[model samples]
Structures are given as structure tokens and as C-alpha cells.
Target: MTRMRIEGLLAAFPKLIGTGKQHTYVETENVRYVYQPMEALYLLLITNKQSNILEDLDTLRILSKLVPEYSYYFEESICKCAFDLILISLGHKENVTVAQVKQYCEMESHEEKLHRQMREDKIREAKDEMKRKANEIDKNKAIHVIYRL
Candidate 1:
């Protein structure tokens, strides 16, 4: 869906939704807003009307659980840690630990290490070539001076 349409739905959402706790979803003409109301915030999943409601709700459930895990206070501060949350979510296969997340961020991949090593080797080789050329020039200059004598 377009950004304008999503924005229109979000703008209309407050008025469209009821104050009661009974409703979990609000449907529009072309879209479905499957949402879970958390304290002071809403965990919302917007999908096309043709999409499966059960799957959307399941995704919202997973997000609801994950959000609270990453952001405890459920305030604007959560936005600041959003990248870290995404990293933690994508970086782990099984249950994730803080140490594992830290390790994942800190550790270099094999390809990256290989590239760094190759770059260092090239720099060393360049320096060695410069030194060798300088030595050759000095020897030529010495031979020229002896020849002049």
C-alpha cells in the first residue's frame, strides 16, 4: 500500500476504533489493521484485505512479545533502540542472549578478516617495494660517484 493510504488509515484509526477492550482488529475497505493495545502504545500490523487474518495476528503476537523484550518502558525511548532490536532479532537463530548479541556485533566475519589481511599485505608490499627502489637508487648514486673519482 502507498504511504498516503497508510497515513490516512492511521489518521482515521483513532476515530474508527472503539474505546472498549473487546476489539482486536479494525477492517477498512481495502486494508486490515490487526492491532494489540499495549500500555500507552499500540502494536499494529497493517495488511491488505486479501491477506490471511490469522497469519497477520500471529505476526502481531510475535512482534508484541519481541517489542516488550527489547523495550521495557514502552516509551519514545524504544525508537532509539529500534536498530539494536532489529539486529538482535535477525542475528539470532534460537533464543538470544545479551552476550551473544554483543559477540555477534563485535566479531568480524571470515570474509572481512580476509579482506583486511589482504589490504595489509598489499600495503606492506608497497612499502617494501619503495624501500627496494630507494636502495637501488642509492647504489647507483654511489657507483656514479666512484666512477667520477
Candidate 2:
């Protein structure tokens, strides 16, 4: 089923090529294929048809720029490193632009933000636990005093 679905998406490429124009995408009823032609290969992304085309184009542009930096040449090694760059590119945004992807790839502020958030959460949890322990101590002290009286 998955293979057939992929093949169906790929089938549109020929028609787009036949149109005698440079084509970057094709939309089907269920999905959209955004493609980037490389020196020896083509990178294609299949997404829901309702997705933002501009963002998809921006992503394709970013990927095209990033791929060369990872492998220097198109091969399986590029695939291994692609995910790292992509996760960096996405940052905290639902829709990523090329500039954001570039900035993230360089600075990696997302990881810093994530670390800071985790630190804050841990501190908050520690404070809550300390308060609970203090309350328990107070309750035990009160009970002992009442027994003494």
C-alpha cells in the first residue's frame, strides 16, 4: 500500500516534465510532491495537499542548500546527516522559513531554550517537593505537641 501510494505520487513528475517548464511541484487529490533537481538526483517531499506551498518551497530551498554542506556530494552519507540539520531547521516554529532554518543551523538557539526550560521545570518541581516535605514536618510537629498537652 505504501509503495503504491509513493509510486502514484511519483507518477505525476513525468507529466510536469512533459509540460516543457521547470516544475518544482505537483498536487494530487490527497498529497503534494515538492521536488528539487540536483546535479545527479532529485529530492522529493510528499505532504498533505492542503499544506502551505510557500513554506514547502522554502523548506526545499533550505534542504538544497544544506545537503551540499553535509556530504559535499550526493550519496547515502547525506541521508544520515539530513535529520540533524532538519531538526535544527524546524526550531520552535510550525512553519519554518529559509532564514530561520539558516539561523538555527548556525546558532542552534533551540537547544539552549530547551535546556533552559528543562532547568526551570526541575527547579519548580524541587520547590514543590520541598514545600510538601515542610508541610509534612509541620503536621508531625503539631501532632506531637498535641499529644504532649
Candidate 3:
């Protein structure tokens, strides 16, 4: 089931690619990194599953927070994309706990709660964005059809 989810994400990635969407891949000469926090997020999502998500997430949070310093060497969009993926993946699961996330990210309870709330807001924003785009497409199609009349 986990692999299935990963596969689904990969399959949908291309469609989600381009136009400010970046992540999943990065390279630095002999070094490379794939922003895949699947295991980390999985731990957070599966309440029953036991793993050191809090510790791992703390490391990630620290790493992520420091990324801005390497702006010249890294792409912020890609970094953000990966973090977004991690958060969204966890948000999809109902087993997530604020404590787990906070502990992992080494954040305060308020910060953790805020992060969770932000995820919900992002979901809503994404829906609104899609709806607006769809309406625009339909409106354009309508105009094209009317032109032939």
C-alpha cells in the first residue's frame, strides 16, 4: 500500500510539473538528493506504526529552515515542493498527531498545530485554485463556441 501511494505520486508528478512546480529531483555534481520524506511522513501518519519520526522530522525542519542560506546553490521552489509533499502526505492520513509532528520537527505545540492548520488551509486553497482554473477554461471554450455563431 505504501509503494502504491509512492507510485501514484510519481505517476501524477509530470502533470504537476512545470510552472513553478519543482522538487523530487536535485543534483550537485557528485552529490544528489531526492526530497522524499515518505518514511518520515509515513511514521507521522500511521499512528500505530512506530518509528522515530519526531527525531527525523526535527532534523528535516532544521535542514529546511537553513535552506534559505544556500539559495544560490539550491532552488527554493524544489525544497518547498518536497516539504509540501511531506506535509500533504501526512495530512492525508488521519492518524497524524500534533505531538508527533511537533516532536519530530522540534517545534512547540503551537507551531505544530499551526503547521497542521496550514496544511488544511493549503488544501482549501488548492481546491479553490483548481476550480478557478476550470472555470476559466470553460469560459474560454464558451467564447470560442460563440464566435462561430
- Give the local distance difference test score of model 1: 0.74
Query: Where is model 1 more than 4 Å wrong at Cα?
Result: 79-149
C-alpha lDDT values of all predictions: 0.74, 0.72, 0.50
lDDT (Cα, tens digit) per residue for candidate 1, span 30-76: 77888988887677777678877776676676667666666766666
What's the true lDDT of residue 109 in model 3?
Answer: 81
Better of 2 and 3 by lDDT: 2
How good is model 2 by TM-score?
A: 0.47
TM-score of each candidate? Answer: 0.52, 0.47, 0.29
Worst 10 residues of 1 by lDDT: 84-93
For model 3, residues 27-93, the per-residue Cα lDDT tens digits are 3333222343432221112222233445444444544544443343355444456443255454343
For candidate 1, give the lDDT of residue 25.
Answer: 93
Flag the better candidate by lDDT, 1 or 2: 1
Q: How well does model 2 score by local distance difference test?
A: 0.72
What ranges in model 3 sit over 4 Å off? 1-108
